[model samples]
Target: MTLSEDRVGMDPITFCDASMNLTYLGVKVSPWLGVNISEVGSHLEQVLRRVGELRLKPFQKLTLINKFLIPHFVHQLVISIPSRALLRKLDTSIRAWVKEYLHLPASTSNGILYATNRDGGLGVPVLEDLVGRVALRAGVKYLLSEDPAIRAMATHSVLQGKLEKLADSLGVKWPCSLTDLKRVRKQQKSNILRAWAAQKVQGATVDIFKGDSVGNSFLRQPSLLKPTRFKTALQFRTDTAATRASLRRAKIVKPGEDTCRKCGETQETLGHVLNKCRSMHERIIKRHDDIVKILSSESLRQDQLTTEEAMLGLTGENLKPDLIVLSQEAVFVVDVTVCYEHKGFVGMARQNKIARYTELQRQLKSRFNVTHGEVIPVVIGSRGAMPAETIKGLKKIRLASKGLLKTLSLSALRGSLELYHSFMDR
Candidate 1:
């Protein structure tokens, strides 16, 4: 008997007279039609539907997407290259689900959703970029395989073009050796993806890109009990919090009507409410004092600490810093200030604080008969952004930056949330 006839006799169902689609290991394979897009859509719809039925927080949903949904596409991606249009459609649907879960406005930037958590974003994975990474890694693996057939197939495949493009994008020369390509793949995998995300948010109005080095350790807190507060803080950091200014930008309010409802003197931006609003003066003082209390508890000795004492006698100016620490060798004047994170405001605040206390530093040294005195400005951003100045100041006082940053950020975010509601609910 012929080999075909023998195979047909051995498995009659497998050998058909007419060409037709077949399911092999749950993936639909056809002689003429290739991997069906409808199948992939159906799978995504089912997964997303199941996700919707679950009671999961926004962060948990993001974790599911990263850990489950993205991996679901990896096998298919490795089998065949999907079109970018399809990937974009899937991403849009997923982002819509995320927006609903987080109660975010449509005006919220997608970059903030896809950026790494350390970069002040929600750390949601981007489907398109994820696909590219998967494909590139798989392609590199096949190209470097020991099997001659796989190596030949990879050399002639479209993946070569992608590999060359990746090299060009990274400023590496094309037609690189196998060793060089493998080195690039190993070293630049995570960085290339992160760079893509960072580049996407470079032009964002709120500047959420925290860079690769400086991490927002607050996001890694282990507690999930305060998801609402976490959501509020996330919204505030991304500039999508329900402030009058954000409402105007989202077109939820009339144009040109974003003036501060409390103060009525300036536009009711987050900056205005958090730092400049007259009606919020009491709450602002409370926020400042709360930070003072934290610092006092962490860094101050009870016997040596002074709180808001008048310095007119020594400095000849009516200045009262937040806290004064009298040590045997040097006296430390620590003043705490929270300002908007944008447009060099934190640096400006730190400089102003130093200048304000320069004369007082000299006076304190003379009055206390200490060898040295320094003014430490604890400058925090209104949205919990820790500028380098804040880190330096915290280090100068021998405070643990991680715990303190988390505490300070939560305090600022809570205060901002209260201010937001106080104006909005009225």
Candidate 2:
């Protein structure tokens, strides 16, 4: 039959004609623009519903969103790119859900929401960013396919052309094969991701210490089942506790509670309470002594280093080493102290403590008649903060294992928390 004669006996629906919108396989196709955004929107709605239903901690919620929610949308992202407006809406809904989950104020910065866990953030994955990442990954897979059909499809794809153009624009050598493309993609992704995180975490109170085993270990530790324990660990790691300065910074309390009730003069900060507060002298001494004891026990077990001796005072001076080790190669004077977790300050504090004991080291060397002597200063922050130098020193001294460092870091944090509570009571 002719086309006009066929239409004479049939309605649009009877002929299976699509007028404005058509739904097939969960995707809504628009006839005019031939765009498939409704499917993405529906998938995003399901993700947001699951997010809203979760009754979990901030970190747990973040984990769920990244693991479950992102993947659900990414399945759709693999097929087509969601419009910018749709992406923005999805982001808004997810952020709102996160804020609701955490009971955060409306004013919380998006930067804090998306920053890395090490940068003292909840580290919620961004939907827009995840979509782009998934698209790039899909493109990489297509380029690596051995099937003739897949290879031909990739060669004709707009994404492949764009990638080549991007390489040329950046002065990067255009990738010729799947392996070279994968390598280039990996490098580009690493640089982009690092820069993205750095931008978000810039000017943040928390500091980043790359290649810091202690920090990495703490972050990688097994999850705490109890919410309280989990939150305490997270707070200590992120520096988000209800410290006087933190409270003041959040404007949760005014100038009244901002000042140290212990010293009654200086502003109470995590650094001050952990390091410089004179009122907590006894507790600080006990904390320092406790950590020293642990080190001494470890040092004594080593055959190369002799038994560690503690509280060795320099005659006619207030200078005293917390622990001293006599190794066959060198005499090691170790001084342990608690200080701020700030990366910059931790190094300075370590160096300052080492410098203070230089004269004492000389005196001890002279008295002991030791030719090779070195001072090893271990400065741990009250909140379980360990300096990179301290980590290196610990490893150098044969205490590098993950279990040992993790135990040490956790112990210091618990001890510091107990001391912090006592100060609060005072």
Candidate 3:
């Protein structure tokens, strides 16, 4: 079925995306109204209570934790403290006693590392990743399930041109609503959202607007935004400016004040350092020679595929085909990606607008045809920079971004190039 605009959930809003597209699988997060809680504590308490009861069949199998649980513990780091008197007293008392009583080594005197955390100290699950996953689940539920409010919102978006609703209609082939517009359900709870539905197109239809019609809107550039960290509609609705603004004010980042050590020119931005500056470009060219060899050895046509460039299509319809690998017998389309978004950070996931990213990937995948048999969509994003939530949502939406294949971040491209060169030379 085609993706619908309303089906795209609040991820765009959470991540402050101007536009987004997403896919929702129909299995887990149906409109069953069973797996949602407004409060985090309440949700956790219910889960624990369910484990204790064990009588009622709770959805253990579908739980995110159960699906993507990790076995690791926190690594404890100690901040150095001054004052020889205090240090000496503690060392003579508790430190010496613990070492002697427990028969522990000198390194063990630092503290305890928990079992859950690989390095182990405080057993805290990564909260930001957890939030991002929650956001994804919410998006899935909002789209595939029978949540009337969400459905109404979707419907309104379809009725409006904000979303490409016709795609869903074409893809799914089902009439959206069973209700008659003639009847007025004044008191119905869903009516609240129905009233809020994006207004109907005024006396016009989308069929007239043809493809490539929509110039840049919020879905494209979000030019209206003043380059702020948090500009999504959800932030405005939830009044989270203070919280979001704090991130923009973070001093964790070192200023981009590095003059190129080699060229004596100012250097900044990962992209500029890696791709643009002439000195770095020369290094990259030197490195790419190795990649060229790999491509030749594989007997596959080689091409430089940049993550930023769209896949190009040689057909009637424009397509941004990233890499076209052809070997007389087979053809394959490859899409390379690098993400700069700080999704792995503690709070970045829940608030990510990954829906748009998910949709774009799907569209690119769908466009592949000239390829041999299996139309390959090669994708790679940073291990930590991309949120687990984004990955989960993308998988659910059917545009999975896999990493098992060789993927090197632009930051490490130089190293990767050298490694590739070394291996090939050997």
- Kindly list the per-residue Cα lDDT of model 3 for residues 1-426, writing each as its tens digit: 233345345532222122332213211121343222223233344444344344422222112222332211001001111123432332233333223222333333121211111111112222222222222333334556687887665455432331233223222222323121112122221232233222121101111111111111111222322222112211221111122122223433345534443444554333333334465454555544433343233333233222334543333334443334443343434333332222243233233323213344444445543233223332222211223333343343233323311222222233323322332233
lDDT of 3: 0.29
Cα RMSDs, all models: 5.1, 6.5, 25.1
When 1 and 2 are scored with lDDT, the better candidate is 1
Clashes of each: 0, 0, 26
lDDT of 1 at 196: 43
- Candidate 2's TM-score reads 0.73
Tens digits of per-residue lDDT for model 2, 106-208: 5455654665545444556666555544555565677678888886766775657655554454334444544554565555445433654454223233444
Worst 10 residues of 2 by lDDT: 200-209
> Comparing 2 and 3 by TM-score, which wins?
2
Error of 2 at 126 (Å): 2.8
Which residue runs of candidate 3 sit more than 4 Å off their true CA positions? 1-258, 263-271, 285-322, 325-332, 337-426
Q: Candidate 1 residues 291-408, lDDT tens each?
A: 8888888765435656677777343769988888776588888898977776667778999999898888788889889898899998876666667667776676666467666777
Ranking by TM-score: 1, 2, 3
